[model samples]
Target: MSAATSRPRLVVGITGASGAIYGVRLLDRARALGVETHLVVTSAGVLNVHHEMGLGRAELEARADHHHSPGEVGACIASGSFSTEAMVIAPCSMKTLAAVAHGFGDNLLSRAADVTLKERRRLVLMVRETPFNLAHLRNMVAATEMGAIVFPPLPAFYHRPQSIDELVDETVERVLQISGIGQASPKAWAGL
Candidate 1:
């Protein structure tokens, strides 16, 4: 049995944030569902994932079908014709959020996201900034207006996850839903 993705390419990225596990679980789950994944991690994302999720770059790299340097400007993903269905900046940082919202595309991740939005393809950003300021809220609104989903990693208590892994998985699942591949491995949820 294999994943049902038809030319289904998923672009997964990690940014500097506290919830690196969200990005990890999203990749893991995607792999289990047999999605061909392209991964890019910012330098800040590498440090943050080590400090927060305790996962090394090698581990993250292993989960991806193709790994592109965050700073590399020549990766295939920087262009729109690479045949990627969507891009998810899981645990999206404020910096990356602003970049994508404003179409900065300074880095490969942001550029890929920009391409996603411009092509009208799905782009899901799991924005993790709490105590949102006016600027953050406005960016979220702006990104949404530009056809991007700014997902905040707020967990629901209805499922009552027993451990941190479950909490992380819940958030990943929530974020994955917007990616169109979420239904492939959905767990039990309440209220249908």
Candidate 2:
């Protein structure tokens, strides 16, 4: 597709995970790259954004090209026909992970992810939990088996990040790279 016609669209889902900043950063990056974004946030995600980033729902929704209600299962993104480059759940909660792993489409976020998987489009889950139990491990495995890329926002010290924002940016950069929408980054490793 030509540049004018091929604006890549990405579906971003934010859940109740601790690192709501990841989702925020992803939106900023996608916007900078001229990518269209469809965003969905769980109710718990709204609470976490307030608790963690002090951002209100309107502020968060304002960052995206379109925002879908969590309960809006009939939304355009819920269908496989919606042409998107990929779907990513930054700070993917264990609850969201379990729902997606089991094909649970209770909400628009999960339904969009399910549609992405079935349509063979890229689906990346930035699972934001630690101290994984057996169930979490199994859920990750199951999601991977179903063609989801389970990414944890593990800190990388090799770049010697000076601040938390740098770390978050680097992780977001990597996430975009995995989705084939990466931007040039100074932090990218040059290899030893």
Candidate 3:
């Protein structure tokens, strides 16, 4: 539909979580769909991305139309008026999750996510932690109750992916659906 071609604006937040590839995959999918993406990476997030995806700053930034520093408040995505369609904190650190859940907008990543919730736009937090304690669950619940989506980096075995990329693509495709792209960008699951 031409209406969907209006291009959704995405705010991607990369935290210091273990699985950084999710954020990269999200950016690539958005770019491929001609969606405008605003990328903001925390210091730990940068290290995680290089460790997981071997993507340098330039290469990663190239995947998005606009890139901002985690500390940069002037970034267009920091304001509630910026009109972002959604914000996804892929590989979202538990620290970041706790911060946003408690209204602690210390940096651009948290601030952007806060703005996303305030604007009633989609806010998907890919909580990248394992063995979640009660505290972590509480934080996630608080975020979800406040209109944020807490998607864990859990891979589904139903797809029977042959490689890591396929598994990654399947999860990333599901996340993309949250942004309104659905399976049209990545191969959709049509029942094998």
TM-score against native, each model: 0.91, 0.95, 0.91
Candidate 1, which ten residues in sequence have the lowest lDDT sum?
Answer: 1-10
Candidate 3 lDDT tens digits, 1-192: 123336777889898899888999889978887778889999898888888788888888898889999879778788876776788899899999999999898888898888888888889999988899999999999999999999996788876789998888888888888766543354545885
lDDT of 2 by residue, 153-189 (tens): 9979898999999999999888888886745253667
What is the Cα-based lDDT of residue 188 in candidate 1? 58
How far residue 107's Cα lies from its native spot in candidate 1, in Å, is 1.1
TM-score of model number 2: 0.95
lDDT of each: 0.83, 0.91, 0.85
Candidate 3 TM-score, C-alpha based: 0.91
> Best by TM-score, which number?
2
How do these models rank on TM-score, best leading? 2, 3, 1
